[model samples]
Every structure is written in C-alpha cells, then in structure tokens.
Target chain A: MSAKQDNSPNRIDTKRLTLYALLVAAAMVFSYIESLVPLFFIAPGVKIGLANAVSLLLAAKGRYKGAFAVNISRILLSALLFGSAVSLVFSLSGGIVSLIVTVLLHKTKLFGIVGISIAGAVTHNLVQLAAAVLFFGGGVLYYAPVLVVSGIVCGLALGTLDFVIIKKIKTNL
Target chain B: MKWRDFYIIAAALLIAAVFLCLFPGSGGKTVTVKQNNETVYTGSLYTDKEVKLDGNTLVIKDGVCFMKSAECKNKVCVHTGKISKKGESIICLPNRIIAQIE
Candidate 1:
C-alpha cells in the first residue's frame, strides 16, 4: 500500500505522462502520413520511418521509458487502425529490436544522434528481413543488400530531421 | 552529422557492398521456385513456363522470372518485376513462395 502512495518513487509525473502521450500521438501521425505515400514503388519495403523520429527524440533526451512506451503504443495503434496482423508482427519485432539497439548505442555516448539513428534504422530493417526469412525461406536473404543500403539512406535522412527537431525543441523540453 | 556518424554510414555501406559482391547476379541460367522452404520447381530461365502455386503465379520467359500474379493483399511480389541474374529473387511472404535465379 505504501508503494502505491502518490509520492511513490515509481509514479510517473504529470509532465512526463503528458510528454509521453504527445510523443505517441506524434508517432501515430507520422506513421499514418508514411502509409499514405507509396514508397514501395522504389522498393518493396523501403520507408522513410518518420514515426521513428519521435522515439529517436525521446531516446536522445534520455527518456528511455517514454521512448519505449511511445514506440509500442504507436505500433499497436497504427496496426489496429490501418495495418493487418501480419504487419503488426513485423512492426512489433522491428520496433522492439531497433529500440533496444538505439538505447544501447545512445548509452555508449560515442556516437551522435545521426549515428544512433542509423544504427536503429539498420537493425530495424535487418530484423524485419530476418522475420521475412523465417516466414518465407533462405532466398529472402538475396534482398539483404538492397535493404541495408536503403536503411542507411533513410536513416541518414531521418537522423538529420531528428537533429533539427531536437535542437528547436531542446529549450522547451 | 558528425565524423562518427560518417564512420557508421561507411561501415554500413561496406557491409552492403560486401553482400552485393558475394551474391553476384550474373551468368545465371536457372530459376528455382520454393514453397515453405521446399523446392517446388526448378527450370531453365530461357524456357518459358507458368508456375501456379496455391495463391501465386510465377512466370519465366526470355531469361527472366517474375510473379505474374498473386492473391495476397499486398502485390509486392508481383511488382518485384523480373529477375534474370543469379542471386536475384522474388518473395511472396503471404504465399510463402520464393522464386530465385540460380
């Protein structure tokens, strides 16, 4: 009962809660926008991953809990709203794995936001590719080179966008 | 972007380049089709053939292999166009089909 007190150490502050909610909303909006665009014309699975920017921003701010919550909520809500069960599985796996890598890289403090974002993006694609191989077969690995290259390109663009956003919002946050 | 960011990008690009070299898509003459990781069809790429699977139709003609049609929600496999070189593949996740050049 003592742990459930309002002043308990585990309780999330109103400010943090509101911030996480806003982050999740932003992530969902980005996901919807991305789905509207047909980047698959260029490649079967290439996407700008604009939604990940919110997670990247939270992670950069050292709000790991907020980042994880935002990422999971965004994926689940997006899947429920506009995606299928198959896509849900793919996004869940990719989102979780990439978040873990991003957090670890951020902890290293050796790389900048761009580097962390690139790592996150690359791992996300690789994990999704692994899921595809599991469902399809070894032949899917043939598409690895393309995914890797696309991950780098998309990650770079996303990272730069995140950097600018973070800079502008740093004072406010 | 910092210098360290460039290094990460370089490493990633190097890995991709290595993969590209490893799976050289040249001098391939045969197309192999697999379902659920099992080989269902293997034939010469030049020999025109239409393979009908549970929910996918693979067509090989003029030294190229492509998914002529698929009953999946996303027509990604069908839109993958054609593969004529070695190490190239068209995968239909929903149908669990993989058509590759070897």
Candidate 2:
C-alpha cells in the first residue's frame, strides 16, 4: 500500500493517529506485564523495561512524535493504574531520558537498532538511579554496578526481539 | 547486531566492571540505616538487631544486613536477602529507606 499523504502540516493523518493509539495501548500492556514479573531480587528496582520496545520501534521508524507521545501516555497511565507517586517520578524521568537517547541514536544511523536500544536501556537505568540518589541520598549509588549489567543484558534481548519484528513487519508507516 | 552495537555493549560492560571493581567485597563491620535522608540507626554488623522505622524493618545479624520486613508495596528491599559488603545497600524507594553496610 502507498503511504498516506499528509495534506496539512498542522494535522496528523488518521492512520498515524490510529497507529499511535495502538502503540500506546501495546506499551501499557507491556508495562503491566513487566510489573508482574519479580526480577527485583537480582537488583532492587531493576526492570527489564519491555515496554520500551514499543517506543524504540516507533522511534526506529522515524516517528519521533508518536514514540514520545506513546511513551509519556504509557508511563502516566501505568503509574495511575498500578504505581505510586514515587514510581511515577522514576518512570517519568527514566522514560523521557531513554526515549530521547533512543531517538538521537537512531538518527545517527551509525549503529543498529540493537545499539540504540542498549543505549536507551542503560540511560534509563542511570537516570533512574540519579533520581533515586536525588531523593534518598548517595547511598543508592551502590546499586549502580548491578543495574548497569542488567540493563545491558536485558537491552540486548529486547533489541534483538525488536529487530526481528521490525524486519518482518517492514511497514513504512 | 552491528559492529557499533558490539562496541556499545563492550563500553557498557566496561563501565559496570569499573563500578564492580570500585566496590569490591563485603568488608564492612557497621550497618547504617537512613530514612528520609536522616541517619536513624548505626550499629555494628556483628550485633543482631532489628531496626523499626516508620514503615520498614531492618535486621543486621551475623555480619550481614538485610531487610527483614517492610511496609512498601513491592518488598524489593526484603527480597534483597543479605549484604556484608562495604558499599552494599537495600533500598526501599517507596518508603525512602536505605539500609547499607558501611
């Protein structure tokens, strides 16, 4: 199918809007599923960040606005549904930082999708750690070693999954 | 994965290894508990004591420290098990509690 034309710069096309909504919903579901998994024993507050795959895919497709909107909406909705105020702060900071890094790396075109995803994952954990330090003092830095390692491992898994899905779908939208 | 992707992974692993080297092992003899950025309790790791905070409980025993219980939702702190290292910590973010072996 030919890509839909955007007749006006001010208005988003209907298909794009629908895609963004679906992405947001998928991101939220991923967030919920991640929360249910108990991986905290490896490192306190460590998450696989499966929800990031959605935004990463959108960002990879050069839909920066859709990625950003879907990510923010997912964070806010998930926080409201299953998180507290503290989690909301962490999620917001991590989500925004990671998304920005992913978009920038994708724009560079020097690295593969896996590289962008890994960078985003590491940045997300680091930003959340900084936020924790800001709130609870420097003691939280002790968790840095484990968080970094976990981020890399988890990011690699998520990135590979995204890469295959992206290749198979091959949608221009 | 591309060559650049491998580079990114290597760089990240290097950073983590650096951090791991910086904080080597469990050599601390003292346990410190902080709530809301205030030091509430500090004691020898050799002493078995249960620290009761506003909403959390920390236990230090047999040269190790752990969260015996907590009032937070996730219980991540409690699940952290034990730590006897100098820079190891059990953090309960929801309750703003940090129990560290220092």
Candidate 3:
C-alpha cells in the first residue's frame, strides 16, 4: 500500500484528516500529562517522553509524515502553553533531533522499538545539552553524565511501553 | 524482540553506565558557582561553607555541596541531591545558579 493515498490539494478527506487530528490531540494530551508530573527534582528537563511513544507508534506504522507532524505540533503547542520562550527553544531542539534520530534508527530496522526509543531519548538529551551549551555555555555539559543515565532509564521504560502497545495493536494496525 | 535488538539495548545501557562511572572522577576539587554567565564564587569542595546568592543558598559540607534552599517553585536544585565529584553539579534553572565540583 502507498504511504499517502491522497494527492489532490482540493480534496480534503475527512476521515484521514480526522485520524491525523486525533493522533495530534493524543500527542498533546500526553505532553500535557508529562508536564504535570513533577520531574525537575529528579533531573532538570528530564522526562519520560510519553508523546514520543506516540511518534514511535506512528513511525513503526510507516506514517513518517504523520509522526513528524504530530510530534512537532505537540512540542510547539505544549511549549507555548506550559513553558517559556527558552523552554520552547529547548524542546524544539530536543524534539526535532529526537524525531530525526528515531526515524533514522527505525529506518535501519537493525534495532527494535526499545533500541529506537533509547536512541531517541539519548539524542533528545544530548541535543538539549547542546542547545544548553549554545544558549547557556559550555559549562552545562557537566550535566551530561546524569542526563545520559536518566535518558537510558527513561528510554527503557518508555520503550517497553511502546513495545507492549505496538504488539497489542499490531494485528489491527 | 530479536537477540540483536536485545544486544543493541544492552550495549547502549552499558555505555551510559560506563560514562556515569567515568565522569565523576574527571571532576576537580574546586567548586564554582555561576549565575547569569558569570562566576560568582569559587571555593574548595573540601572546605565546608555556605554560599548565598539572590535568595538561594548552597551548603557545602564534608566535601559535598547541595542546594540548601532556593526560591524556585519546584525546588529542583534542593531536591537534585548533592555533588562531590569533579563533573557533578546541582543546577537551579529558576535561579540561574549552578554549583559545580571541578
């Protein structure tokens, strides 16, 4: 089956649009829930990347455009609502880099959902660190070790979630 | 799912762990506090002291430093525990303060 069946600009398929809108809404809700969870005490800016799981699901289903759209819109909207301009920058950098890494890793098919999720998590932190260095200074890299550890652990948990969810939905999807 | 996938995850985790273990050793004994891109205080981690800045206080005791108090809402710095190694740091983003062992 083709990845995208609709090419006509004038024809707006309500069903596909509704599905994509639902996915975006789901991603936003996950992002909102994640913000509600107080994770700062654990590590500054560390998160479980719940919305990324949705993106992973889309990527696994070969809906790359949908995944990217959902992930990007989620980041922008969440940041605007729940964070500052600085946070918007941080999430944008991290989310974009993370999406790229997950997509590339998923394309390779050399790794499972767990591995792709791990890579995405780690890349998110690293890129956020880079953004920190760029915006803050080189001194921020000192947080790298902790971020790495947090990234791996959170990735493992979220990846397992993604695995189970993907497995359960595999037949229907 | 596959053996290779398991290996990939294991390897990634091993690398992260190895890095965590190795990084702390590279930190120096000097502790520096920075705010707004400026170094505010430089001291010895071995010397127990208290640093007060912009209503935030960092307490260093027994070679470990932690955010004793902060005005931030989350108090993440206060909850981030302590730092004693060279590379370890407690960052209070709300206050724009970073206490690092270097």
Candidate 4:
C-alpha cells in the first residue's frame, strides 16, 4: 500500500488543516466582536451571538470534524481573552447543548443555520440559569421565567441572522 | 438554505422580536399615580429593579423591596412589595410608581 494510504483519513490533511485553523481564527475575531457589540437596552446578558455563525457555516459545509474542532478552539480562546473563569462554566454549558441541537436539526429539510443559532441561544440561557441556581441559590430564579422567554426571542433573532448570512454565501458559491 | 427559506426565517424572527419587546417582566397590579402621562414615584430606585442594592447589600423577603437600614426617608417606598411580574408598580412618597416588566 502507498504510505499515504496507510494512514487514516481522519488524520488532519495539512492543507485542510490550515484552512480549518484560518476558520478558527476568524471565529475568534467574530466572538470578540460579539462581546463588544451591544445586544439591546433590556437584559445586559443577551447578545446576537454572531460568533456561532462561523460554526454553523462549517457544519453546513459538511465539515463536521472541522466544525467541532473550531468550536473547541473558539471557546478556549474566548475564555482566555475574557479573563474570567466563570465564563468557562457558561461556555461549556452552552456549547454541548448547542452541538446536540445542531445535530438534531441537521436532519430536518427546513432547518439551517437559523436553527443552529436558535439552538445555541436557548441552550446558552438554560445553562446560564442552571449555573445561577447552583451558585446564587433559588431566590434569584424569580428571573428564570423572563430569562426563558427572552431566550426564545434572542435565539430566533440570532438564528435569522445566521440564515441570511448563509444564504448570501451559498448563492455566490 | 434556499432563497425562499430566508424570507420565512426573517418573518419568524421579526415576530419573535416584537413579542419579546412587548413582554412584561412580571404580572402584578399597577399603582398608576401618574400626572400628565408621566410617572412620579415608583418604589425604591435600585432595589425594585433588584433585591440587593448592589453586590449583596439589601435583600427583600416576604414580597417587598426593603431597606435593611438606611437614612433615606420615603421608606414609604417600603410599601412596594416584591414584584416579579410585568406591569406591576409601587408608588413612593413622591407619588412615583416603580413599574417593572413594562
């Protein structure tokens, strides 16, 4: 067998690996910008979550492994730059939930990056609330109901943003 | 993923945003002590928005924004009970109302 044939295809291809690295760097830039941008006048915590758009693009492009790697790198980089350990908690909580949602939605014909954003937003809120309860206690959960409602709204908004950007990219390709 | 899908998603998001913008925080009674469509007093400034004044200072229990102890008069803002619902209000000594979830 040829030497190249002996190795597993799962091993990173240098060319594709480089491309994935570039995508990850771009995702980090977007994540940083997301932190800087103002979400709205209401809850200070909510945001458009634009960074996850990069992940959606990867998943849609059929680079599932590359997409997962991009996700891990982005989360680590974001937490490091932000200088907060607590954020790691929120990120982990949000990330796993989002991945699950994306995979499930991936099977649907109507679903797209828009669905991915909605999943990310909703999962982010759920994880954040769970963290709140664990650390701050139950009383603070009075804010729980409102947060859930807001989550759904924020999720759909971010989802729509993703949907538009993806559509624009697809047409030109 | 298609041209038509874009329009469908956009419309859905527009509706969701509109709904969220209009959602009230908690559902409580309105004090409604306005003069010319302007609200005057609305319970304590910070506590109503939050139970603790800041960073774990004061806590409201049994349904009210209470001062653990302070020199601020109009503790009458004290009368405003803990409100978690939208459109709820507590009138202060200045005839102001603390509106939440509006």
Pairs of colliding residues, candidate 2:
B26-B85
True contacts kept of each: 0.55, 0.63, 0.28, 0.05
Provide the lowest-lDDT 10-residue window in model 3 chain A: A8-17
DockQ of each: 0.29, 0.31, 0.18, 0.08
CA lDDT scores, all candidates in order: 0.84, 0.84, 0.78, 0.56
Which regions of candidate 1 fall more than 4 Å away from where they truly are? Answer: A1-3, A6-11, A171-173, B25-102
TM-score of 1: 0.71
Stronger candidate by lDDT (1 vs 3): 1
Q: What TM-score does candidate 4 reach?
A: 0.59
Descending-DockQ candidate ranking: 2, 1, 3, 4
| Candidate 3 clashes between residue pairs 3 or more apart in a chain or in different chains | B27-B86, B27-B87, B28-B86, B28-B102
Clashing pairs in 1: none
lDDT of 1 by residue, B40-61 (tens): 9987675578899889999987
Residue A49 of candidate 2: its Cα lDDT?
88
> lDDT per residue, candidate 4, A11-110, as tens digits?
6766777777888788888877876777766664666666676676666665666667888788888788774888887776777667656655665656
Model 4 residue B59 CA deviation (Å) reads: 7.0
Q: What is the DockQ of candidate 4?
A: 0.08
Cα shift from native, residue A170, model 2 (Å): 2.3
lDDT of 1 at A100: 96
The digit string of per-residue lDDT tens for model 2 on A66-164 reads 788899998999889888999899999999998999998889898999988998999899899899878755445556777888899888888998999
Better of 2 and 4 by DockQ: 2
